[model samples]
Target: MPPAVEARPRDVRGYPVPAITPWEGGEPRFALTDHGRSADCARQRRCSVCDVPMPPGPVWRVVGATESAAIAAALASGEPYRNLAPTTEGPGHRACMLYASMVCPYLARPNARRGSSAERPDELTAHVVRGAVRGELGAVVGFGDFEYAVTETQVLFRFLDLVEYLPHDTADTHLAELRAELGRVR
Candidate 1:
């Protein structure tokens, strides 16, 4: 079971708040990250969504299958996958990440874009955004041993060893197919 909606912290709009969500002058900036909180969660091994200590086990992440496949391809080819592709988001508990995917507007809407192309200035950032497939296709729930690292501008997550993956919506057959393809390559 997931945490009760009311039990989680809320933003001004009464939506369950994520630990990395930023606030500007007391208003939630859903599109932005709070770097300080993000770093704390990473260093302390806490859930990015619930801001609680992660249960002992693999950390979970909600990812786009397209991006997962790309990483898998890069890894198989002996490319520097970690440096070439770092997840801007941090890891969370399985339940927390699942719940956030269902409730967060950006994650819940399949066709929504992160922002204009201008917002994604670099090729890597743009490529990452392309992986944000959601809704009927759902998202990939990845379980892995991960560690935290800080770049000059942001905290990054690197999955040291991927132990498992579960598609968020089993009914989304497309996601299952994609996951299977990723399995073949990874």
Candidate 2:
């Protein structure tokens, strides 16, 4: 008899695929965001911020201690929450949160001094907002923290889309610290 292989991941139609295995080493794990190896996730990209699948294009990546804190608070509160800027959980429309990433206090951190390494120890380095899709507000993440967001809890947003994918090598405005990290390696 042939050895049975791991069951193929099921396509939930709207849900983004979750990683069955985590990054074992310090390399990097893109699964934390919409960047997964699953066929559905690849076939259609969803906005990490709005949870709305969209045409693969340019999306906004949110960062900074404040945004992080808000996410933590939102999860802990366990209430339908909303923000003017992009959320850490998903991709957002460039037109929706683009201006925020460019001006958010924590994002800019003008007064904050650059760390010695220039590389931030706490991030995937980049998030790409790909193509677009117009779908109903399926569901909102439940309760959780920076580690993870609860699935199917809130009813705030409907509609998600894919904008893009940010490889470890590419750095956007959110990755200001790691902007030229690869260049410095040489």
Candidate 3:
């Protein structure tokens, strides 16, 4: 079994190297995100975590806490409201999911119960993008400060307005499959 998650997650070196490196596979992908913030981002669209150009179509990303405020408020107030959903990050790769799920506190910690929030949701949410998303993508929180915390360091995004949302049920279910894939990697 994979080791249990610690109270705090630590970075593992040499992680997320693509199974096939550019040397072996061909060119590394790089492109500007549809909502990228900087010219630099436009020139180089890489996973902030692994610095890889995310492959096209079907990647996951979580909406920032601020954007989820409505969801939280609704959950807290017990009122039904428009679901403020987590959206996909602009074009990026998902190769880092296993390592990320292992070490990222924002993700399910090691040994997170199968049914725990670590596992399920109407929408695909990752501390970072790990699967595919469909819906009104909220904001593209690009450049921001990395806030250090006991559990892990987190990046806070500068959010934009609510965008179109894809039907929750219609969202791709790749996250569930990816979660299962972690068992093999671990």
For each candidate, the alpha-carbon lDDT, in order, equals 0.62, 0.31, 0.31
TM-scores for candidates 1 onward, in order: 0.69, 0.23, 0.29
Candidate 3 per-residue lDDT over residues 19-52, each given as its tens digit: 2122213333221122223222224544443444
- As a TM-score, model 3 comes out at 0.29
Query: Per-residue lDDT for 87 in model 3?
Result: 36
Worst 10 residues of 1 by lDDT: 115-124
Q: What 10-residue stretch in candidate 3 is worst by lDDT?
A: 142-151
Error in Å for residue 77 of model 2 = 49
Highest lDDT among the candidates is held by which one?
1
Model 3 spans with C-alpha error above 4 angstroms:
1-42, 56-59, 63-91, 95-101, 109-176, 179-186
Clash count for each candidate, listed in order shown: 0, 40, 10
Off by over 4 Å in 2: 1-43, 56-91, 102-104, 112-186
* Candidate 1: stretches off by over 4 Å: 68-84, 115-138, 168-186
User: After best superposition, candidate 3 residue 20: deviation in angstroms?
Assistant: 20
Tens-digit lDDT track for model 2 on 29-93?
A: 32233224222222345433233454544444444444344444655687434554323344344
